[model samples]
Target chain A: MKVLKGAYSGLIFLFLYAPIVVLIAFSFNGAKSRGAWGGFSFRWYESLAQNADILHALRNTLIVALLSAVVATIIGTAAALGMHHMRRGLANFMLNVTYLPVLNPDIVTGISLLILYVFIGINLGFSSLLLAHITFNIPYVILSVSPRLKGMNRHIFEAALDLGAGPVRAFFKVIVPEILPGIVNGFLLAVTLSIDDFVISFFTAGPGVSTLSITVYSMARKGIKPEINALSSIMFVVVLLLLLTVNIRAGRDIRRRAQTHVRSHSPRALSSREH
Target chain B: MSELIRLVNCVMAFDDVTVLNSINLTIKDKEFLTLLGPSGCGKTTTLRIIGGFEVPTSGDVFFDNVRINDVPPYRRRVNTVFQRYALFPHLNVFENVAFGLRVAKVPKADIERRVRESLDLVGLRGYDKRASHQLSGGQQQRVAIARAIVNHPQVLLLDEPLGALDLKLRKEMQIELKRIQQQVGITFVYVTHDQEEALTMSDTVVVMNDGVIQQIGTPVDIYNEPKNAFVADFIGESNIVPGVMHRDCEVSFAGRVFRCVDTGFAPDEPVDVVIRPEDVRLSPPEEGQLDGEVLSVTFKGVHYEMMVRARDFTWMIHSTASEPVGARVGLSVRPFDIHIMHRAEKTEAAS
Candidate 1:
């Protein structure tokens, strides 16, 4: 039964990832013909390294991602805290409004943001692209952080107040620390979404402020180039490493907290101690 | 005794439902006053109003002589040890205790000294570095107490602080809480649904029901001399025998006449004569006043709880010796132990 289950899982994995594997494999083809299997070569990778336009797009993408992630984290954390304190009906309505950007079609969101920018007389540039990215990224952060806030014990805040803390002090000392992990997780999620954005960036970015995803689309439309494959491979590796790091850190934190909870609440441990 | 806190004609309503109605109470300084009631009887609501978490719909809350109705919870010179201790999971014992002092911007040395002193007072001095979540429920509750008292607030509000513990832990903590209150000499406004807990720890007990104060007096007064049917039924295990007041000092129940010490009721007024189980004596038929057959007998350690059926009603009697089931027994209650209270509807409504 276990072997059969393992086989079933293996088949599902291949079915899901086989297309990506084929794309990566074809990117390394050294033959002149695109369809035929070819010997491996480092020529595509070398060509990718020399592409100054791609490098510039990559830098712009990184800048936009960092800017949007920071802004989204700040705004989303504050919104989560606000919603946490609000009445249930009002909080739910506001949460739905915040998440409208994520649920709306990308093309519609892109067109609307473009119209908004033009109406506001703000020219498309790195700032406009960053703003557009943040509009979508913030909802994800808020969704992530709000649940963590709800799960936290409200008594902690009351305890802080009882211990003589004013409102502002209690928020920073108790509320913030308890929700830090959720904030970090949300920030990373925003960063990933911002970096991978293409359609929204295509509409919002100016000629010289193109992001890496937009550059990749333009390059792919021109021709099926091996250099694009090399670029994608690198981006995929970076994303994989980032996801692994985040998952490991989050898992460790959860495990540590669970162990601490168990140790403190165990009857044997509580009764054995003289104090 | 001087009043430390007073609520004058306090009325609190949530939306259309009134939770506390025209509450007038004066808590004396250094007194342990308990608001005792069944669940959802406005005891907790009253305590929350005193803690400044809830504003009264139309009334004044006074701390000493100052009107504090508009004060926010953080600004009130009162602290509440919540039913759930609500200790900060991320902070250690010392930091939890020191949080208020730190927020007040006290110096580091002073914060350390006060935190240590508070922890020592709660018998947790050596566990300073232990995380709040790394403690048992009882320990967490003690830490909560230490955290509140460290601020030296004028009044400490405890809202069922020991309700979550096991029986053994609860009894132990009750004694500990009494000792701590005596040592601190701060006004304690405790709210609980547990009648025994209120009776054991309170200097004064306020019995409330359905958003109105039923009675307010010392624990003995509230328990032994309940003023109405509700108060008599709620405070302890009572065999309420519905009867008619024959005269000023006489009541007729179950086709029999008994003399009671209570007076002030008009002739032929419907009343309930409350006899506590422990106060009713069970003996052989010749030595007792009422004769009945034992329906059941439950051994409760030092005493036997016997239920005797007399005429149309059953009465619970506690005795030193066990009475066999189906055995004829006699029940005798002292005239002083027979507390007579008027029917609830006839009493004047509190305004």
Candidate 2:
């Protein structure tokens, strides 16, 4: 049974990552063709570094993702805070409304945003793409943050006020610290999703505002570019590093919280350190 | 002691249900007064009103003879040790204790000195670096107390601060709390449902029920002279039986006329008779005032608790002697042991 379970997990992992493994391996190939691996070399990477169009696309992707993630996180966290204090029924209604953007098909959101921008007489370019990314990224941020707010002790806010801190000071000193991990997680999720998005960017992004994903798609339409493989490999490693840092920090937080919970409930063992 | 805080006809109604109905109370400086009652009896509501957490629906709250109904909690010189010890989880012991001083913008040196002094008062010296979560329930409770007292408020409100500890820890903290209150020399308005804790710690005990103050007096006064059946039953174990007040110091119950140390009732008026369990003495069936069959008996460490059914009412008697089940026993009470009280107009059974 143990062997079978191990085999099953191994097969699943292989099936999931085999294609990425092949793409990464090919990025180091000297050959220009996908099927023929004429030994390993850094020729494709060297070309990818000097490719102005691809580099420009990479710059656009980073700018759009970072800017949209920041704006979306601020708006979404404020909305979540507002909704956290609402009456239960109203809060539930608003939460369901917030879920609509995440649950709706990306194509639908993209087309609707495109049509709205055209009708509103706004030019479709980098700003339009940025707006679209922010709009879609907000729901992810709110979804991540609302649970932290719910888990918070409701009395801490009142305790802060009772202890001589005003409302604004209490919010920053106590409430923000309590929910900060969730905010950071939401921001990371927004950045990842905005970078990975393609369907929405394709519709909302106008001429000359090509993101990395859109540029790859356009290059793939003509012919599979060997330099694109190197680009994807670097992007994957960057995302992997980002996720590792987040997971490590989150693990430390959970462990510290768990230790506190255990200590609070354990049998009262006085250390005899009385004055 | 002088009056430091007063609630004048304070009424708190949340939506349609009234939590406090025209509560009028005066708290004295350096007095340890406890609000004792079961849950939802408005004891907590009264404490919150004084803490500036709740605005009275239609009445005024006075602190130092100044009406502070509109004053917010931070503006009031009062702090509450919450029931759950709502210590800031992100802060260490020293920082939690120093929270109020930091917000008040006190000097850094003064804040450190006061924080250390308060921690020492709570017997938690050298624990300033420990996080709030790293402490046991008793330690957390001490931290909460230290946090509240470090501010040097004129009055400190504790909402059942020891309600979360185990029996042994609770007993220890009860004494610890009393000593801390005296050392701080601030008026402490404590709230709890435990009558024994109230009796042990408070200089004055305020018994409340159904959003109204049932009785307010010293512990001995509240115990020995309960104004009504609810106060008598709530404060301690008592067998409250109905009786007729025939004349001064005379009442009749359980098919016998008994003399009590009470008077000023209308002639032939119905009254409630309160008899403490420990005060009832056991005697021979023929020699006692009332006789009954013992239904059950259980040893309660210091005393044996026996339930005796006599006439129409069951009496709880605590004695050093044990009476077996189904045994015939006689119960006798002295005239001073029988307390007569005016029957409550709309008495609901004590919870």
Candidate 3:
């Protein structure tokens, strides 16, 4: 039964990755037609380097992702803190409303934001695109951070204040450090959503401001370029490298925690000596 | 000694649910005081008010004859050893202990010296570099104590600082905390739900329940002469029975009139009578005050606790000897052992 379950999961993994794997494999194809298996070459990678349009979209994607992630993290974490101390009924109501943008269809949220921007007479360019990205990203940030705020011990903050730190100092010294893991998680989630977004960016971005996802969608109309495949392959490698770093760090933390547990309960502490 | 802290007419209601009701309390300088009560008894809320974490709804808190109602916690001359030992997880023991000193902007050399001294006092020497998670619960508690004491606050508030420890460690830390309190001569206001912990470590134990102070006295006074049935039952094992005060030095209980020392009640006034478990003695049915049947007997390590039913009252008796179940026995109570008080409005039935 266990082996059968393992085989099932393996098949599911292959099904999810097969297309991306094929795309990456075709990025090395010497021929332009992705359907035919051409001999391996770096021709597409060289062409990808020369593709300035794709480069501009990539730059736009990075800027939007970075700024939106940071701004959304600040706003969302502050909102989570405010909700942490609110009355249960009101907090529940606000939390339910916060989930509305997240649960709604992405197209609906995108078009609604676009309509609001147009009504306000704001041009649909970098600023509007950034604002729309931040608006959609904040709900995800709040969802990830709210649980951490709820789990924190309220007395810990009071302890910080009682230790002679002022309210502002205590917040930075105690509250921020305690909720930092949640904040980073929220920021990373926001960045991924912003980078992968197409429907939202397509609606809000003007002609000069196109993200990588929107660029890919537009390129699909004209025969998809081999250089786009190369770009996708590069992005896959970058994401893989990021995941590798994050997983290694998380594994180290778990091991360090286990080692600390063993050392503390080791019958004799051996007194961690400092010279 | 003069009062170091005074809470006058303090009333705290959180979202219309009263947690502390018109509490008037005073803390003397250089004394170890403990607030002892069950959960939801408002002991912790009172401590938070003194620590300046909560402003009472309609009362003034004074420190050295100065009203500090508007003063924030950082400006108060107080530090706290939190219940869970809220040590900063990101900092090592040395840094956690030095946090208060650094906040006050003490000289770096002095901060180091004081942190070392406080850690040494808690017998956690050489634990400076250890991370908070790298220490055991007892060690974490010690670090918390060291951190609070390093600031040298005029008053140290401990909110059940030893609530999370094994019995042996809890006992050892109780004595250790009392020793540290005396050594520093800092007014320590400790809160705990454990009656034994409060009695063992505190110079004065204030027993509170239902957002009101039941009684405040030394351990001996509180134990030997409880003000009401709640104090008697909460402090230790007791056999409480309804009785009537006929006059001064006279009372009727267990279906018989008995002489007693307590007085100042109206004639034939219904009262609550308290007799400690150890005070009830056993003898042959022919040679005692009241005859009863032995319902059960159980060994309680130091002594065997036997339940004797005399008339309608089931008396808990503590003795070294054992009587078989269903054996006829006589229960005796000396007049001096019987403590009486006017019946509390919320009478508690004793089993």
DockQ of each: 0.44, 0.49, 0.38
Highest lDDT: give the candidate number: 2
User: Candidate 2 on A1-275: residue-level lDDT in tens?
Assistant: 99999999999999999999999999998999889998989998999889899899999999999999999999999999999999999999999999999999999999999999999998999999999999999998899889788867788898999999899999999999998988998899888888888999999999999999998899989999898899888888878877777677668877877787667655433322211
Residue-wise lDDT of candidate 3 within A114-133, one digit each (tens)? 99988999998999999999
Which predicted model would earn the best DockQ?
2
Q: In model 3, which regions exceed 4 Å deviation?
A: A1-10, A35-38, A240-275, B348-351
Q: Tell me the number of clashing residue pairs for each predicted model.
A: 1, 0, 0
Q: Rate the local accuracy (lDDT) of all candidates.
A: 0.86, 0.91, 0.88
Instruction: Rank candidates, DockQ, best first.
Output: 2, 1, 3
State the DockQ, from 0 to 1, for candidate 2: 0.49
Instruction: Answer with 2 or 3, whichever has the higher TM-score.
Output: 2
The TM-score, computed over Cα atoms with residue i paired to residue i, of candidate 1 is: 0.90
lDDT of candidate 3 over B265-300, digit per residue (tens):
999999989999999888999988999999999998
B69-157, model 2: which lDDT tens digit per residue? 99999999999999878899889999999999999999999999999999899999999998888788889999999999999899999
Docking class of 3: acceptable
TM-score to native of every candidate shown:
0.90, 0.96, 0.92
Candidate topping TM-score = 2
